[model samples]
Target chain A: MNIHEYQAKELFEKYGVATPKGVAVKASAEYSTALGQINTANGIMVKSQIHAGGRGKGTFTNGFKGGVKFSPNKEKAIENATAMLGNTLVTAQTGPEGRKVQTIYFTEAANLGKRPDGRDDEYYLAILLDRATSRPVIVASTEGGVEIEQVAHSTPEKIFKVQVDPAVGLQPFQARQIAFALGLSGDLFKQCVTLVTRLYQLYWDKDCAMVEVNPLLVTKEGQLLALDAKVSFDDNALFRHPDIVALRDLNEEDAKEIEASKYGLSYIALDGNIACLVNGAGLAMSTMDIIQHFGGSPANFLDVGGGATKDQVSAAFKIILGDKNVKGILVNIFGGIMDCNVIATGIVEAVKETGLKLPLVVRLEGNNVQAGKATLAASGLTIVSGDTMADAAQKIVKLVNQK
Target chain B: MSILVKENTRVLVQGITGDFGARHARLSIEYGSQIVAGVTPGKGGQVFEHNGVKVPIFNTVAEAAKQTGATVSAIFVPPPFAADAILECVDADLDLAIAITEGIPVRDMVRAKRAMQGRRTRLIGPNCPGIVTPGRGEKSHGGCRIGIAPGYIHKRGKVGVVSRSGTLTYEAVWQLTCKGHGQSTCVGIGGDPVNGTSHLDVIKLFNEDPETEAIIMIGEIGGNAEVEAARWIKEHCKKPVAGFIAGATAPAGRRMGHAGAVIGGAEDTAAAKIKIFKECGISVAATPSDMADALLRIWKG
Candidate 1:
């Protein structure tokens, strides 16, 4: 689940990560009060708290590129923040959403000095799975921040990796190795170690898929701090961690996805008219490809998953039919552990309940195929049956086009 | 003559007290699997009859394995406790462990894999339809029971089949049966990326089987295992092999199918794997119906 920048920072603070002291103001009046809360005003950065990235560029309508005009006069800061807050900010990273800021973070901004060598130190730290080793690996780079994928791909050697054993967790010595490798010493080095250790704990404790601290900056005073943070939790592990689930901001998620989650079905909305519901993930993807291959677009990719009961199938069907864009429905089941007849019965029941009028095409195999088809046939629903996947694709494509 | 299991192999059922587990356990025993024992933590000391065979229930896999000398284990534990069950079976040094439990965390499987790295124990799946030794014996942990493949399919001569999909494995076996070619062993390695075993792992066993003359591999998208297997087959496999990858036309991106079956980034795709297998001199079946035809051609040649 994706959270807004302010929410992520809030979580970081809760987890004992040092973040810039700030106040989140929802409205223009709140912004006036926010300025008074800033204890020191060397230079305060008013960041639009949107879900998307790249908020720095073209986010503000009036193009306050250098910085928002902040004065002891709280009225000016409020005027500037209100204009940027509600208006959509189109950043390269924000994509098409161009996040509409609900709240803005008015916080103390940091000023940096040159490195020990009179050069800027560039480095970021991230902990992610090392696919090759099948272990959690810590990634540290001299080119801190920006897109780490690009750095890993273009110059992999520059990214220092240390694999952590799950039993021992992330050892301090290993964290220190990364710190020293990144050219840190003294108090700053200790701070870096502490932050890295904390990040690893967050990754394990929260069952996070990734914990990234971008721009792990070494200030002019040689103080190490995580300037930005991003944390992603494993959706499968959400059952074990209720606290992380509470962090989910439903407003930030796609409406269809949120609805699909309620049914315990994995649904990803796509721009297509034919809703494809298949039993297995591999088969579901293949069905989507087949739909596209036949000149039909798949509206959603829905997998009922293995061991799905009749109710779950019905729930999945309802979710698919809920989409107004879906002109046709394709039910593909290669019943492994599941009974095809049970699935067929569920489909018919779901369609009856929803009063589905869309063209339905089904291709079922394995256990109870005959019984499943018989049940569907007996249902008297206007359903089409295909002997094979190719036939199913053709029928669905033809039906969708007819619609 | 069959692969991992046969009529004589002693089988232990884990999670036998559960609804689906009990049902399949009864079916497998009725179908001719040698039901030796059952395991369910608190349900130990109870007796479950499988086709008139009174099997003693044990508290753990270790006890069941020790008492019954069960070489093969059919695990039906739920997702949460599946990893521990598998580890227990591995600890007992079972010859083969079939994890019928679905939805096991990939991280858990990763740890299990690490633990079983050098062990002789072979794992079929954390989520898969359990293997069958044709008409002689079957160990089905999956809920569905369509009956075992007919005895006629086992000419006991050659042909080793490996598949990622359980349903497709049945199809492949059915196709082989129609061609009057019986399988030496049919292995469902499972579709999950971090599953118990890979196609390459099974192929090595098949390659070493003197009775196995040819190999038919059924693979799906989402992992590089198929590609790696193709490379291995090209370099090391002495037996003639036929291959077919399911989901050749699968869309690019994450789609709900199997937890491990998403096509993200660059990896072994159906088409790419097919191309590789073809380059490796293995005949590729274009469709499920054509799989048997492809294998027949290789057998005749």
Candidate 2:
């Protein structure tokens, strides 16, 4: 899961990596604390806290200049924050609709540019999986603040890689090697070594899938700092790190998605009108595919897993209908380990409670399929049952188009 | 002989006391798999009896393999300890180990894969349906079910199937079986980004097997396995191959993801992979029934 910049910086401090002094403004009311407290002789960076990248290049839909703005005074900082709070920030990554900025990070902007020892030269640093090696790798570049993908694509030689052994871990010697590679000297080299080691430790200890420090900087004082922080933890490992999970912001997530997760259902809202409910992740995608192939667009991707209960199935229906864009529903279940009858009961339960308005097409296969079909049929509901996946997709498309 | 498993493949179960472990163990044995022993730490000397058949439980895979001389192990350990479970089987020196558990951390899988490199054991999945050889279910029966695949949907024949999905594999096999194109063996390589076996691994085994006439390869989005297999088939596969890719309609990127989900590699989307397969002289199936059609068109006049 992705955490905000403030949380990532907090982790950086906890792990011995230097970061610009920053405070998270929980709401527009708390702008005073964020603006007044941070010591920014260089300037204050009014950074809009969203989950996407390209924030510096992105503009707010509310006619703000940038998601991040460097201002000289507290008044300007609060003004930027006021413009950013609750406004939509559209980045290349955030798509056209954009993400609603719920919080803002007020950070001390640094004195950027070349120092006497070439220490102010910013460099890109990130630790992520090099899938080919099946190991964690550090990608470092002399060019910083630019997209690392662009750098890797343009000048391949400038990008340096250090593969950290999963079993042996990131060795101190390796960290030193990276420090030397970045062309650091003396105390700066040792400080970089410490920062690199600390970054590795945070990544390994936190079960983070990736830890990126864009524009990992060196101050005029020969100090190493992470100018930007983006770390995402593996969701599977989240159970072990409740402290990290607690950093999750509900405002940053889609309400429908959060509700679906509570019911143990995997659901992603889309721009279509036909809602898809299936058993496995693969099957769910295929169901969506056939729906599109049949000239219908899927409103969402919903997978209830192998052993979902009747209540979970009911919850899935409620969540699917929660979207006003949904014109029809398609339930395609191939119950191998899952029972079809249980799914059918859930469908029946959901319809009885919510009183279905939109047309729902049902296709049940595999174990206890007859019982499942019987349950739907006997419920006195207008659920359309198809013989095959293709038949069901076509039926849903026809039904939705008619509406 | 069929690839990977047959009637003589003695099996050992890891994490045998759990619901999935116990249920699948009973199903595998009943479907004629020679399940000799089970392992659940601290539950040693216990017996899980199903339908008049008792499976002896051991504390360690080492003990299970040693006492039973089991060459194959099926894993049902929970996600947290699953990699260690796989490591246990790998260290025990089993011929083939299939991990039936899902939700294992990718890092653990990477470490497990690293450890298994150049090892004697061949691992199948950490979240797969496992392998099944048709016509070896029992001493006299016609199937040897290793995973949770529905036994009713298979029949012994000349086609070898390898897939990354569970029930979708069943879907394809059912379509083939209904059309008189019985399978030799079907293996689910699991759907995770990092898994034990690849499509090429199973293809290599199927290519060498004389009993297999045609191969059916099932793949989905999110990985390079299917594309790699297409390359391998173009270069070395001796038999005709039929291909099907799930998730033709999978969203290109993650749902509000930050990183790690945005993969630049493997443009192995359904259309892309199908284009690759078609370019590599492999038949592509758009749907489950299309799989049967492809196999029949390749094998028959």
Candidate 3:
């Protein structure tokens, strides 16, 4: 449900929050036209657009000097954009594998020279739901250049928080309070107040799960600009916002995860060999737990849902076997209203169609247990049957390790 | 006596004409739940037959409550309007309303929760499986079932089970039933991020109920509800409490298919809770079968 920074800034602009002038360029061919859009006095900042944070400090695996580089002219801007476009970016958050940088944003760099207070021109601001209070909280700090997580972990006292009552939305007084907490005055302070207020308005109106403005800049002229932005929307609330849903980038997500969501299935890819297909969320977790306990790693976390049909079950199984790393498959069903016979038939059909070549173990319990077990047994596949959860987990782990 | 509903407890169905509502409504009546009325907006004045037992349908929960005098209401409304349906039951001043719908937006539930502050009505499961208290006598609605749980699996006994999952609660109950220990009641508080009830809420109810001797808490790697309950159990709970937590080996940050199943930044993982439960004198079960053995030892102690 997370949107890219450029998309977030576009949405922010609609809510009257001023974002730095930038044009998202997907290719070096369009770099000249995009650079022409942002008319800056000293050129622009070329930022590689990826989903993960720490992109500013990220490096391109293609031997590019930096994912983000300041270009003094149009020539250097295209050089930086060419280095980033279609290159993989490796940051602390992107893991060792890194994310592919599909677009580079050519943005107007702000003049955040030295302030009179001798401090750098960076501040941290974010709005997120505080689970402890079950309310939206605005977190602000003066130190923003470093990773906010490190600041949050070490010098938490430096971080200030104010919870917003949804009934009142984001009041002007609360925004001013945050503005004052960050130590601002005169025209600069008033600008901060206006910027904070508009940001809160966008967060509230857009139904955003999180709105983070790390290194919210305080320019030499006292004007504020969001140097970096990240926004994630509530997935359940996406039904109300179709325009926002269209901003979802499928290329940024795992293909299996996107495919699973299409079928109303929940799948999380893991680095294990045993694929787990269970009924409920808790059951799936427990199935994974016991597998690890018995010395087996889970290939993926797949839930076919409580009321899944034969086709959905077959779909779930095929998705699991699609992982070539799946040395074994465990079909765990605790059928209550979920007919056990239907699950058995689905497993049988999926195996028949996919042609199972690995170890398969199944444990079925609950309503129509007799018929469901009968169906699986009659499938005539060389599938191991387990009477209990522990027994089933042990069987799969053992059978897989034997190879 | 059970915690919430009993045989004589009159049940009202909200979103009665909907697929889940109509189906569970019939199933509830067959299980001996005294389903007095049904509520579906604009579907009033209709007679719904459940196992040949006729029930009246009302347009609103207010009218249904007024006419049927139903003490409890269970909702199967869709996610978008599920909170409002719950609010209707709350406004009608029902003792409890169980929302069986899943995928309700957290913001809507948070507002619903705030409006429920100091209200007479109690809520359970926006995405949860309903509450079940096994019928004890002839007058009992076969043991009152306010959810989709089948009645055949339950046995009228003392062990109380509270869980954060749907079918996993069924798994725990089956394990208990197989171990010759029938449950007094089982509550699935749903797996949503923000829910009305918690493991501690039902644990408190079970602690007070004389019928519930020992308790089984089914928690996963999520919010610190399990750890909080473990802390409370160490100080106040008089009866033995056994717990089974899922997601022992789950990776951090993944949602694990349940909204409330993510491991928090703090010490809220299953392994962390197991360590806490061990320190609190609560038997922690690794597998569901291990829970059956642990519960047997706990009640016996």
Candidate 4:
């Protein structure tokens, strides 16, 4: 659902919001060409295009200093791009394993306007759903180019929020309030109003979950430009927008997670030993918790949904086993609408199909639970049967630790 | 008496002709719910026959409510039109509208929720198991089963249950049933962020209900609805309350199956919510299996 900075800028331009022109390249050969396409007169910013924040402070696995580099010329730009592309970037957001930087973005570095006190005047603007109000809210602040959470915690007064009515949408007076709150006036104030209006329009029209422009810059030419763009679309509304769907980068996603989605399974990869397969999101999450509570860590969170057929179960097993960190597997089902017997038969067939070598624990409850448990018992497999969630978690932890 | 629904509450089915709607409608009727009318645009004057009971169908919710005197509606329309279906319920002025449809766009819900301001209808969920008030019968057959929850797991008693997830609600209900504890009513408020009801909303209803002696509130990581509910329970709720928050190990910024289960701010984590529950004097369940036991730890009945 998240798109890179370049793609977001493209959207900003489409919506008539000004941004520093940028080009994204996948190879070092295209790095110079990409830089040529942008206004690199002042300077070129080589940014690693991965789906995570804190790129400026990130380090490449190849001992490179920074994921995002400011190069004064084309030679240093290519050097920075070479160190980033095809290298893994470790940021505060991307876990210790890091995300592979597959694309490099080159953009023109804007000349930052200075305030009366000789400080760079940067501002922050973001549009997202305010859950408390159940409406779209525009968060604006005078402090920008830094973590907004930090600003919120340190100086709560500096932050200003304008909640828009979903029915009426962003009003002109509301846009003016944001501009005035950021201390804008004259032409710069007019530019801020236009930018805010266009961004809000893009957010609503594109069905974006969030649209954030950190360090919303004021250039020396009296223009407002979005320095950094981070946009994420609402996943449920993606069905209406095929153009947005094409922006999804499979390389940035976990392979097992992408594979699990194909089977209608919700899978999130984690770093642990025991793999958990459960019905329902909350149960799956608690399954992981109970595993850790019993002195074991879960390798992944996989929910086979309310109704899982035989092929989906088999596919889930294949996806779980795909993770090398998995030392054991736990199957927990609290069938309500779904029959436990069908789930049990699928588990039995999945175990036989994968020829699972790791220890397996199964817990079935709800409709036709006895027949489901009986199916698992008659499968002639070494599947540990658990009477409850607590018991199954303890069993799996003990089995994995014994190994 | 139940808080929202009972044995005598007449119900209508929206999108009754669809596969998911028809299936749960049949199940609700089989569980002895008084399903009086069906609403399918252009399918009016038709009768849906199932298990010796024939229910009349109508073209709109207004017609369905007027013709059948149905006060409650169970919506199973698809994602695209689910919002309009909710609006129809509001326009028809139904007493309660339970949206069983999943994958409704949040924007639609926001608009629908805004339009519903000052309205008379109380909406339950867009992606939920619906409400169930167990009746005094074999497998609770005479109970008002509004949504897709299995009726047999419930038992008519003094305990009230509220949760965000469907199967987890069933898990807690079954746990209580096995331990010889029955429930007055169980409500799933759904897992979406912009749902009609909140944990606090249901908790207040349960606290006010005289038949509800104890409460079990289940929540997950995401919004601050659970924390808000817990804070209210500390100052206002008189009954014993037990709480369990899922997604303790869920990574940040990942949607854990449910769209609303993602950890957003510093205050919405499972650990934070659990700590708040403890501070608010609500017994926290260590695991999902311990929901009933947690309540029993604080309350004898």
Weakest 10 consecutive residues of candidate 3 chain B by summed lDDT: B134-143
The residue-by-residue lDDT of candidate 3 on A187-252, one tens digit each, is 868888888888888777667878999888877776788878899887888999899999998889
Candidate 3: residue A39 Cα off by (Å): 2.8
| lDDT (tens digit, per residue) of candidate 1 on B1-301 | 6577765788888888888678877776655567788999998899998657798999988899889898888888888788899999889999988987777765677678778878989898767766665552222221112122222223343778887766567666766764677677777676565787778888998899877889999887776778888899989999889987776555564434465565644554677777888998888877665677787787762
Worst 10 residues of 2 chain A by lDDT: A111-120
lDDT leaderboard ranking = 4, 3, 2, 1
Across residues B1-301, which tens digit of lDDT does each residue of candidate 4 receive? 8889999899999988999889989998889999999999999999998999999999999999998999999999999999999999999999999998889888899999999999999999989889999988988779999988999999999899999998899999999999999999999999898899999999999999999999999999999999999999999999999999998999888999998999988997999999999999999999999999999999999
lDDT of 2 by residue, B113-227 (tens): 9899889998998688899887733222546778787776788888899987776787788778767777889998887667778888899999999999899998777657788
**How many Å off is the CA of A22 in candidate 3?**
0.9
State in Å the error of residue A331, model 4.
0.7
Candidate 2 chain B, which ten residues in sequence have the lowest lDDT sum?
A: B255-264
Q: Pick the candidate with the highest DockQ.
A: 4
* Per-residue lDDT of model 2, residues A1-403, tens digit only: 8999889999999997999999988698898866678897788998889998888889888788689989898888888888988899999988788999988899998877585566557988899777556788998887887888778778988898999888789998999889888888899889888889999999988888889999888776667789999999888788788999999988888899999989888888888999998877667777787888889998888888767788888899899989999999999888866778988998898988989888989998887889999999999989999888889999999999997
Model 3 steric clash pairs? B7-B140, B7-B141, B32-B141, B135-B143
lDDT digits (tens) for residues B257-287 of candidate 3: 8877777575768878899999998988868
Give the Cα error of residue B217 in candidate 4, in Å: 0.6
Best by TM-score: 4
Off by more than 4 A, model 4:
none
lDDT of each: 0.73, 0.83, 0.85, 0.93
Q: Estimate the lDDT of model 4.
A: 0.93
Candidate 4 per-residue lDDT over residues A1-403, each given as its tens digit? 9999989999999999998888988877777677778888898998999999999999888889788899999888888888888999999999898999888889998898998988888999999999888999999999999999999999999999999999899999999999999999999999999999999999999889999999999888778899999999998999999999999999888888888999999999999999999988888999999999889999999999877788888999999999998999999999887899999999999999999999999999999999999999999999999999999999999999999
CA shift at A69, candidate 1, in angstroms?
12
